[model samples]
Target: MDSALAVRALDESTWAAFAELVEANNGVWGGCWCVGFHVKLGKGRTAAQNRAEKEQRVRDGETHAALVFDGDRCLGWCQFGSPDELPEIKSRRLYEKGLTTLPDWRITCFFTGKGLRGRGVADAALGGAIAEISRLGGGVVEGYPEETDDRKVSGSFLHTGPMAAFEKHGFTRTRPISPHRWVVTRTVA
Candidate 1:
């Protein structure tokens, strides 16, 4: 992999690259297209439907993500948006149970290209997402990442990313949403 990866905001101009990455990753977890956290789940939409809707959302400016690219190839992404923009999330039952205030933005998922894990792509995607958030008017940001310390969680199940990824990016644990899932919060100025 090239060490000179650049981060780009997912938008109309960058949609193709984003699509390519998703398609290459088997629609990102059973053809999810990373839409599982963006809308109500169990909708029974096919991969094709998910792709179409995701593209429409991008055109409508209803979705958000930071795409990492190695030249023209998208290596991965970190999906983030307003709570309303990303209403669904992991451990929702417990997440809202202790919710006091909703974050200005929520990082719902991450995806790295095949054989690209451990190459800092996700970390870069996270930083890129925060930078994009700041550019879009900085505000309170939050994410749910698993506490992977001392545990060997498969990368496939780490769509929410790892706790270390958030902590190093300045997010702090606000509360534990589940046994392994923690709500991390940080304010971007």
Candidate 2:
């Protein structure tokens, strides 16, 4: 056995590990439950609701993510889904301004354990995501990654991960959806 982080689909079987990671991280981004991209969290949206709905989606196979695990403990996850499955995104106005075609899969967000920051967890989660996408019938995959080259970006805002991380995994820049965020794409086959 390679004592390496393995990627597993965010299904019912792995829901416990995923939930544990989320719980440890304050439900992730103010109790988002990693569902911000799937559903808009307006005012009054409680964390409990997010968790419940997220679990339902997982059971229904409506949610998709690659959960990264070291041994049996989940360390992080890379969320990816169809455009319709993950419609709500950052920079929506800019992201949709020049939209022509939708990628088969959208890499929405990534969350790592609190103690594992600045490590290779994000990269591993992304690699896991691409591999999972390939296993699900490869096609055009897109990610909205922030370019962290010139300035110091707080890790708290890197839910979508960084550009260089995606680049090493074969994703190329398609366009700039925001000042520092680039719409990166790759054909995973």
Candidate 3:
């Protein structure tokens, strides 16, 4: 971790920094605004609309994310919320195939700046999210991270994050969700 790294929750004061980071990355997964898991997918929405929706959620205090910062620059973030807050999983059927229960919170996605990819930004963000969740009230938090063997995976495809990062933060793998992804969890205390 960078010595200057700091983490903060997404709120009005930090919304601009978050927005700038997303905008720089071409709106984050084709102008997603990190809303793909929050709402239904494929609603034929434009990038601007997605941005508006995300901004509204932040303004309404209906979203949660741990934004990582290096001084004034926003490096990345980890998106997390209650199960109801983020219900749209990409592999829904597979994710629920053998599921018996839902977690108190889900760490759905992570994003690091374009130029800062391999600098432990996502790891720091994950740690921050865990700490924030713990402060709110300890509970079982779940995450879906990609499991890469000796194969190469694109950075965009690893948005959920890499399995190793989660494990490094004390998350344990529960089961496989997809061919290259696994359901991992950690009980914050």
Candidate 4:
């Protein structure tokens, strides 16, 4: 809620914060790190393998998203990278129609701690991701958000942030990849 809250690129110091943010809020995916989709769908690595590789990537400063912080604490997580940066997303059916060479930034994942949910943490992260991408230079931003009919909270939901939430952040439906999946986009102009 504080406009002074800042979103900074994922860094080593913030790595623990990012992990803490997820573990404190959503334990299932948080426990494994944001490597589930990337590992299973992209690299086909075991969970332990994925964990080690992700850790190495962070150590190597190859992070592709920004961590949301309120003062010194990390409160949320968002993943952004050029489509090419995430080979797993391209291998998935949901992104089949999205052009790979367009130099687009894809928001493939997000997580907010339980106490921070419904408090606009995700909106701030999305805004921060867009700004980060735009700051680097205007590029198409894509996100696949889940279509939820009733705004009910579910503990099982992870990956693919809420469609309405993305819409609220200025993302529009670019395509309906499935009954519950929609590809949303916001072109920086």
Best by lDDT: 3
Q: Give the TM-score of candidate 4.
A: 0.81
List lDDT for all candidates, in order.
0.90, 0.90, 0.91, 0.70
lDDT of 1 by residue, 1-189 (tens): 346989998999999999998888889888898888877657668899889989999999999999998888888999999999999888989988999989999999999988887778999999999999999998999999989878889987788989988999999999998899999999998
The list of candidate 1 runs beyond 4 A from truth reads none
Model 2 C-alpha lDDT versus the unseen true structure: 0.90
Instruction: Tell me each candidate's TM-score.
Output: 0.96, 0.96, 0.97, 0.81
Backbone-clash count (model 4): 2
Assess the local accuracy of residue 33 in candidate 2 as a C-alpha lDDT between 0 and 100: 97
* Candidates ranked by TM-score: 3, 1, 2, 4
Q: What is the lDDT for 27 in model 3?
A: 93
Better of 1 and 3 by TM-score: 3
Candidate 4 lDDT, 1-189, residue by residue in tens: 567678887767777776666556544353556765455534444445555666687888655676778888887867887755655552267557654544367888887766676666777888888888888786788887888877665734646688877888788897777777777888875
Q: For residue 89, give model 1's deviation from the true position in Å.
A: 0.8
Residue-level lDDT tens digits of model 2 in 153-172: 88777889988899999988
* Residue 24 displacement in candidate 1 (angstroms): 1.4
What's the CA error at residue 159 for candidate 4, in Å? 2.5
Encode model 3's per-residue lDDT on 114-186: one tens digit a residue. Answer: 8897777898999999999999897999999999886899988899988989999999999997899999989
